[model samples]
Target: MDFSSKLYSIESELTQEDLDSLKFLCLDLLPNKKLLSIKSNLDLFKELEKHSLLEEDKYDLLAELLYIIGQHSLLRILGTNKWAMQETLKKNRTVSLYRQMLFQLYEDLTSEDLKSILFLLNIPKKYEENKKFLDILYYLEKNEQLSEDKLDVLEKAVSMVSQELLRKINDYKKTRVKENTSTQSLYDDKMKLSIEVVEQVSSQDRGMKSTVELVQHVSEAANGKDLMDKNTESCMSDLSLNEQSETEVYAMNRKHRGYCLIINNSEFMKSDPRLGTEKDADFLTNVFTWLGLDVQIRNELSTQQICDCLIDFKQRDQTERDCFVCCILTHGKSQAVYGTDNAFVHINKITSYFSTKNCPTLAGKPKLFFIQACQGKTHQGAHAIESDAVSSVEERKTKITIPDDADILVGMSTVDGYYSFRDIRKGSWYIQALCENLTKMVPKGEDILSILTKVNKDVSEMEYSKDRKTSMKQMPQPAYTLRLKLVFPIPLAPFKPLFQETN
Candidate 1:
């Protein structure tokens, strides 16, 4: 044989080590055939058939491997053989059925939800079949014909898909967890602690074990189990002097720390009209609250109102709190966000309030700022590191001096000068991605910087644009000055007693 033919022959041979490893794919799932007969990748499928007796994990592993292998082979054989082309055409129909099934399961999904879900599942949007899935979803939602039952099914499917993608992303994340592996703990790594309580309570109780079911249960319950305004008040009410109890110190202690301040500016002066910010505020409030922070949400604040709020938060006594987070959802050009009354508040002005010299209570704490407004009024021609609503393009680096002991992290939705995209119904892309990843990563013990890095990846990969002919892309930017790692601890249980008598 010539050199090329020899190379092919060598590639087709199964080495001893490979044979040893292949056994883990399961002998039962392997077809009854000679291993040497497979001269090309296309023919490998004939040896990868599964038997009914095989365990589920082995079967799944074999299936995933075979699917990948077959995909490669099919691309190599594209249009070469008449029979092969015909078979591939038939398989395309199967993929169509699967896509249709996904839509049927989540009928009420908005266009934005469909896009976010696909990205969350690591599904590729390049394929025509996937594009059709989105096209149909957009149409149905526009017509307001999607069903609630289907929406429920879609959420479950999205959760399953995320878990599957995460596993596939890590080679060591096998289908079966080893008995001695520490990963086999009683928790799903993706769950936030508050959501975990809701889930486990429902499961051990045998009534429900999911976010949706538990929320519905609370709403249906007779007592004041309502989680929104009422529970949030209970969380904040501890700060009041009149409501102070002797046992309060055990729960929250004397320090007014661990609060998430969300400033949502949806309405704007007639000069700069925008939509969909309110959606972001609502979702973020729910998420941070579920993450165990006492949330303070305000909407439609003007420039002065914005300043006052941050100053108040900065002045709070945070001795016992571990960290502080502030989120802003609004519109603006470079270097500032617009208050509801159309006034500009420089981003630094809001953040500077937390400096060690200014807010001594938060001197060493991690003060995080999440801004979801367009920084400038320019686009990088489909390739911009940008933020929410709309912004221009410009690269800026400014250093302001502060006291020696200060810790801060500022997360901008985009780079200095580009438009930040948001769906009229779904909210800004950055905030949604941020909330989901925080929920997914925090329970698994990921640090703040690592979690923000994932948020950057998640937002950057998603394709967003005002029009399809010229699609847009976004890349988030994080700037921080810290003396130590900022890892928000998981609150395993409720702080019921609130406080205790000092020593």
Candidate 2:
């Protein structure tokens, strides 16, 4: 039963005392002897928490209030929530004004029998998130205060929303696919034209003619530059190796490809040499190259060299690129990797280089770090951690600390304080699994993080037992401070751009 109907059915059994109690409750909720605020209804429930009434009594009172409010022409049903009968107050709008507008909208909506509700619920579905709309559905499902039938209606409504959302998404994808096909055709024509221009000029080079000059003079180009040897390809780079879904081929703002920095530290003098590191680099080079990255492979780097290499990359212009990725194949300790000089460079230092404040060109772009190194010594332990001892009390005040707002992801070969599993023949388990899954999942339209999760699951589940009692287990860990969903070989329409909203 609806809240109103249920209250009407039970009102016959209630005495004057019960009705009086509800009237007193409602009166107490009024601000300064009047319904002075829009939060009066919300405050009524909040204040009811202090009462010791039975659950049924509380329900009865709530239903009675709802019924009375509806009957008294108080249809301005709205709260701070998005799907509330009223509109949510904006940050700049006062509650009273917001409430008035919400009621006006509600009045307009009710005249058409819930037309607004259906329209609001049908939020546009994309690969990116729609937080407000999705949250409203979540709120409806989790609200236990509503009756069963009402909840059922909400569930069905949400189901229809999902169905409609899916159809719209599929249609959108079809349209994009069509658009992308046209783009591809245009790119191919440009490439063919450039090739013809280049080959034609080269054929007549015996005369006083330079093909470079001829191509530049004849072919129309952007920025007065010749479009020769045009690579008619799309790159997924760090986010994807082959997934076309993640590719943003036509983005004039984003780069055609990102840069991949490979640091292979194998010549460890103070420690055991990390063999098979080259295999990892070679394989990744091919993978990332196929994925459309400008692959840079460096060998035998010291701590300072590693730092300097990153600094150099950071200094270079990357505004034309979508992201930056670094892969280090080396031995390591907890939170640090060993350079060829056997010096330790903390991982955070490397990541800090790409922060929005430091790397302005890559401000809003993704920065991926794939480290194949040991964290520290570890063993399986599951127990309650003892609390820290109390210290001398001092004056304290609340302080709002904001987190770093940059898109950076670090993928580790093993959990902290654990050994990474590897083979002298096949290279490290994590890197191998990452490469394999990237190849497999990219075509299937899986995003970078999902692909990484699969890599982690597969690596952790692998059995490398020397005997029945002895085995090796390696769990990869990916830590990220990403502000947006990242896909490779393609880009999705961002609901809103982060880090690029200029002053």
Candidate 3:
């Protein structure tokens, strides 16, 4: 199936009317520009006015028209002159539509419009229902174009919309049930199935919301969004005290030191070296170092050596250190990672050392582990006809096991029963995506979990084929029991353009 095509179709369904309104609005908003194009602005506006008068639900259409007018002014300021407009048209792209529409509306968008959109967002909402609109607003906000007053209005609007929508939905359902009793059995069956599906969706939504809330609280505390005057003890007991004080007790001192250990055990017994493991170690080391952590890279370490390193790191002084990250790059079999000596070690032994009871220093801190190894012996190779000439090698055993209390986040390269990709000269597919995602997300105030989620998405979308003709897919999975959110410093924060005006 063409997933992209299906997604486009669905998006079209949602935004069809919006798009039509946008086109009509653009004609009025960009009269001079429209005069330069094939369509006459006057004719289009006349038709739109007629349609607006006849339509019962004209608010959205009017809003779109106003938004287009705002966008036209912003575009002019952004130096999108006649030539640029013509170029956009030649490319067969609609310049003032969807995400692009927000840019055009940026200059003329009023506080009310901003509030209306924000109000829609503040209420209980599904991201899918309004992601595009939110994306546009976020873009404008990021550009320092959105006023604080507008943002406040938007927030209240979102809350109000959410409440109103909920009430309307409930009322509609009740009325439909009462008025359509003749088709009761059919309705009953449909409603029963709908309720079951909605329940599942609600459960998933709750899980996501809980996760997001935890991350948001952590971010706010870390970024000084809610700082407290008192220390940990007083802040925890006092309702008036801000939560930042409590979080500060567990915060990683910026000046404090931390270490990273990278272990690569790619070679199996009588097997050639695997570059994927080496790349995993290298990528992880770079990421940690970028985050201001002292890093040590080790290759071809035996299982015992790996264990000893973790034990030593756990014994470090809490006041002088921050967090620890361990990256294991190796070939494996079922819940275990392999060492250079062909030794089998359970992953739990490496992680268990940093638990609350074992390592007091890292008790409430974050401990991250990136594992790039096979999880099982099952081979998922391409068929002979479509497969590459490369012959399949015998499956190897994994030696390391992970512990339950490790407070460690493990990001595995691929799901079990699948082969991870590695380039002989470069690195593994997972490492490339991991590096890219970390580089992008870390600067955007995203937590470790959010970054990992993006990495999972990138890996899932990538396809690998054994022979040039066959396709096999592999996706990475990040499993974590993190007690705290990990926030890396943004290197370019000081240079960001600041907002000067309020709505």
lDDT of each: 0.55, 0.55, 0.53
How well does candidate 2 match the true structure in TM-score terms?
Answer: 0.44
Cα lDDT of model 1 by residue, 251-329, tens digit = 3332443889999876666444446676677777876776667899988898889998888888888877767889998
lDDT (tens digit, per residue) of candidate 3 on 398-489? 44445556457878887765567665444677776887777665654456776888788677877767668877677887777766666665
Q: Count the backbone clashes (under 3 Å) in each candidate.
A: 23, 13, 29
Across 1-503, the per-residue lDDT of candidate 2 in tens digits comes to 55444434445334443343333334333342332232333333444544532143245335334332222111112111111211111111112221222222222222222433445445344411433322333344345422222333443443444443333333333444554565576677666666776666667754676656675644664222233222212211111111122223223245457899999877676766666566678778877776778899989998999999999999889988978889999877667777877777778888888888878988878889999987764232112111001111321222211227568899988877667755554567888789877765554334688789889878877756555787667789998877655656422221221212112
Between candidates 2 and 3, which one is better according to lDDT? 2
How high is each candidate's TM-score? 0.47, 0.44, 0.48
Model 3 worst lDDT run, 10 consecutive residues: 239-248
Best by TM-score: 3
Poorly placed runs, candidate 1 (over 4 Å):
1-257, 378-405, 491-503
Model 3 segments beyond 4 Å from truth? 1-250, 378-406, 492-503
